[model samples]
Target: MNIKKTVEKIPGGMMLAPLFLGAVLHTFWPGTGKYFGSFTNGMITGVVPILAVWLFCMGASIKISATGTVLKKSGTLVATKIATAWVCAFVFAQLLPEGGMVKTGFFAGLSVLAIVAAMD
Candidate 1:
């Protein structure tokens, strides 16, 4: 099967494919990272730092010659996204317990961090 072609046919599949795979892995084998205990564990737990560098590169790619109007619009959209995510996180925090959600129920492993990441 042509996995690249299959993913290309689905809207946003390039982004969603890895997410689906990760979710499956986390659900079925949450200890897979710890089991491997080295590079695999680092890859699993080091997502934030890697993502920060990727995002920095993305931001740095914006051309300095872009018009003020374009920058303003993009800035407004980004601000709105951040604000909405913050509000959602705040609401989730209020609803969840002090340490966050439960670890072994229907909502197991769901946390404010995940919610914010999904929202933003």
Candidate 2:
């Protein structure tokens, strides 16, 4: 099997297909979690498989990109995006209502994690 051909096809197959299927599933099975013990657990379980697949794909992509320049450029872009997102989240958290349920520090940490994960 040609890996390059398979990778090229992934934009339509792995990417769009999952997005379309997710939309369809969400539309048809909306509120299906209410029947489960806890909505949070049900939601997590439903999404875990997708998340696993995404992580595997990400690992594969990184493995295939052995070029130092490509890695450096990708790292810079990811860092910039993550820094921007973190600043935005921090600013938004600070501006939130006094009684807001979100903790500013927690959100900042989450933003950092998002950036770290993207780099990985």
Candidate 3:
């Protein structure tokens, strides 16, 4: 079986496939990565290398001159996403007796995670 061919079958597989595999490994054997050496642990920790390269490429490819245009195009989506998130957070906060999002709901700790991970 061609590894390249198999990976190519899944979109973004070059990046995501390995991530899924690692997640599965962790699910079966939690903290397995910590037992590995520093290098392996670092790589497994969060796919930092791939993330760095992805960020670098994303920034590097954008021409400074078109930055305004890029921002303009993305600004709408970003603003909308943030606005909706804030609205939801406000509503959720109101629901909570503490007047805040700390630990509540069937999804205990979910509100905090959602707010923290909310993206632009």
Candidate 4:
């Protein structure tokens, strides 16, 4: 199967694929998480350069002309989405009893991204 095509066609599948694979890998390997944690310092160091490049690329892509109008609309949409996500997360966290780790993290990250993306 063409994974890229599958990911593009199915909504949320792209995100789910990595998550499912990680779960499966954890289940099968068991010790992979421990090994992964052991190598975290190296991973953190390596990620700095990659993150810097990403930020530079993103900064380069920003358009000066459409800043005002685009930012206004995008900010409103982002705020709405963040509010909805927060409500859903709170509800799920209360109902689950297990404490919705994924949902909570997702909503938290989404809120942060929205604020950053909407910033002037």
lDDT of each: 0.80, 0.62, 0.73, 0.59
Best by TM-score: 3
lDDT per residue as tens, model 1, 15-51? 6775677678878998987999877766565677546
CA deviation > 4 Å runs, candidate 1:
1-66
Task: Please identify model 3 stretches exceeding 4 Å from their true place.
Answer: 1-45, 99-120
Worst 10 residues of 1 by lDDT: 45-54
TM-scores of the candidates are 0.45, 0.37, 0.48, 0.33
Task: Give the number of the best model, judged by lDDT.
Answer: 1
Candidate 4 on 51-118: residue-level lDDT in tens? Answer: 56556776677899877887899899989987777766555556543433334544443433343345
The model with the greater TM-score, 2 or 4, is 2
Model 2 residue 47 distance off true place after TM-score fit, in angstroms:
9.0
Error of 3 at 17 (Å): 11
Per-prediction CA RMSD (Å)? 9.5, 9.4, 6.2, 12.8
Counted clashes in each candidate structure: 0, 0, 0, 0
Candidate 2 local lDDT, 18-67, one digit each (tens)? 65656776688766556555754354346776677777777677645476
lDDT of 1 at 49: 53
Q: Give me the overall lDDT of model 2.
A: 0.62
lDDT of 3 by residue, 1-120 (tens): 899799989998877887788788878977776898676666667677657866787789899999999899889888898888777777766775563555655857555336636642
Candidate ordering by lDDT (highest first)? 1, 3, 2, 4
**Pairs clashing within candidate 3:** none
- Considering only N, C-alpha and C atoms within 3 Å, which residue pairs clash in candidate 1? none
